[model samples]
Target: MTWLITGGAGYIGAHVARAMTGAGERVVALDDLSTGVPERLPDEIPLITGSTMDADLVKQVFAEHGVTGVVHLAARKQVAESVAQPTRYYRENVGGLATLLEGACEAGIERFVFSSSAAVYGNPDVDLITEDTPCAPVNPYGETKLAGEWLVRAAGQAHGMATVCLRYFNVAGAAAPLLSDTGVFNIVPMVFDRLTRNEAPRIFGDDYPTPDGTCVRDYIHVADLAEAHLAAARRLTRGGAAGDLTVNIGRGEGVSVRELITVIGEVTGDGRAPVVEERRSGDAPRAVASAARAAEVLGWRARRGVREMVESAWQGWQLHHGK
Candidate 1:
């Protein structure tokens, strides 16, 4: 079955496209090219330039490509930006999703896979966050994702479509150098950027309750995350019951900021000590995933470790930045 991957030329989107097509799945990509590099996608996989907010364009792509399933990955993801511009986030993330679902239901599309985030859980005080964990998003970006999930489930129930929401946690690394994330929004890249400038990396908080007084997170490799998407897509394509399946995509392991930075220093051979700063607001002391549901439901697990993530990400940074 041919699947339409929204945001298919972006960093994570490109990885998903490569993994799906490598597994012999027919896939097409739709990207606005705002932050997406069209050259990242294979020439065989058609890259349609448009937005999901455009109902006419969404419908046109669905009909013209004969798309039987959809893997929606297009959305604004910056937490600080979302907080600053809540309306824009709602319009683009939630409103755009509503439009896409309408087109999917109207087209009789039955399979859908949503790209969700662990941010929906906020700063839960649990050791390992499970699928049933309470969602109390501290930022507007997370709020939009939670709302999008609700809309997806509601649309699925009404239209008899199988849907899955994968809440990703701290996505890092790259499947290839070219596919590596160029933006410095994430922690790994943020640290890389500072090091590239011959400056010390800054740790947000060193007074938290966690070991080393830093935030702890579960980092998953981009390639493994892509495989999880393929697994979710295949599960839907196999004709499962018409319902919603939500799971967290993580390694079920926790790595503190200090530990990760030390590994980064080892990888980059620039062991400059990180400067400690005041804890950022809305920072979670720990946000590790249980990862049991993903393994049981999708039969997928993360094979790469923290060192691999840093090494691969550093390689990608050097490739793109000439560092």
Candidate 2:
């Protein structure tokens, strides 16, 4: 009963891989090294160097390892980048899933997990977004993710592929150093990186409708989010029915951008604040998860506070960069 985690050597994928392996599950990771690093995974787990978009490679990995389940995490994730390059997002995020689904459905891999994004909600009229929210995505990145989920759903109907889609917001922190550098990727670490160098973190907007006049979002610790994935995997392993199980993996509360800078200051013991800038395109006024369904259905809720999330991230940053 082996499981395959695509993009397992990357940020959140590495954390999920560590948690699953710690629970004594036999796990294998497949990554193309485009954004993944080998050092992020534990020594015992096997990593295949290939893209999930490759039909032959996907089938070969499934057959070679006798995989029972899959956690698909590999995708082009930047919302701004997607806006710039819509075609690449479609090909990799949509086309790749299409190819992988063909192989998984054929190989009888029933249990499947997908790493979706809150971008699917795309600045909903409601302050908080629930699973039932109308998914009117704003960017190509979100569109592709929604499309990927649809493909997986089709597979669930055609074959008995029990699917779970975790709609993610800000997935950050590093429990283990999978990459050599922390600040090279992600918005959270990028801000932290600026602070470490005594530079002002960029606050894209500060005149929003929220309390702090900044964009508000629910940022979940990657560790807590990873556990939710494992629980979904367990449900699938229990011969769960073939249907779509969509859950938002975030705490119910929202944090403003300015508040985040203040929190980072508190966590790092620095009084430095962020530098205000013009609003970044595609940013919403407020984005938070209504995680009731996740807690009720998957028995999962994010327990870590904003402080812990920042502290763990600080610890990871210090560990990686010695600051």
Q: Give the number of the best model, judged by lDDT.
A: 1
Local error of candidate 2 at residue 99 (angstroms)? 1.2
For residues 36-143, write the lDDT of model 2, one tens digit per residue.
878888789999998988899999999999998999999988877898999999999989888888888899988899999998988887977999999999999999
Which segments of model 1 are wrong by more than 4 Å?
Answer: none
- The per-prediction tally of clashing pairs is 0, 1
- The TM-score leader among the candidates is 1
- Candidates' lDDT values, in order? 0.95, 0.85
Query: Cα RMSDs of all predictions?
Result: 0.7, 1.7
Cα lDDT of candidate 1 equals 0.95
Write one digit per residue (lDDT tens) for candidate 1, span 6-84: 9999999999999999999999999998899998999999999999999999999999999999999999999999999
For model 2, state the Cα shift of residue 222 in Å. 0.3
Q: TM-score for candidate 2, please give it.
A: 0.95
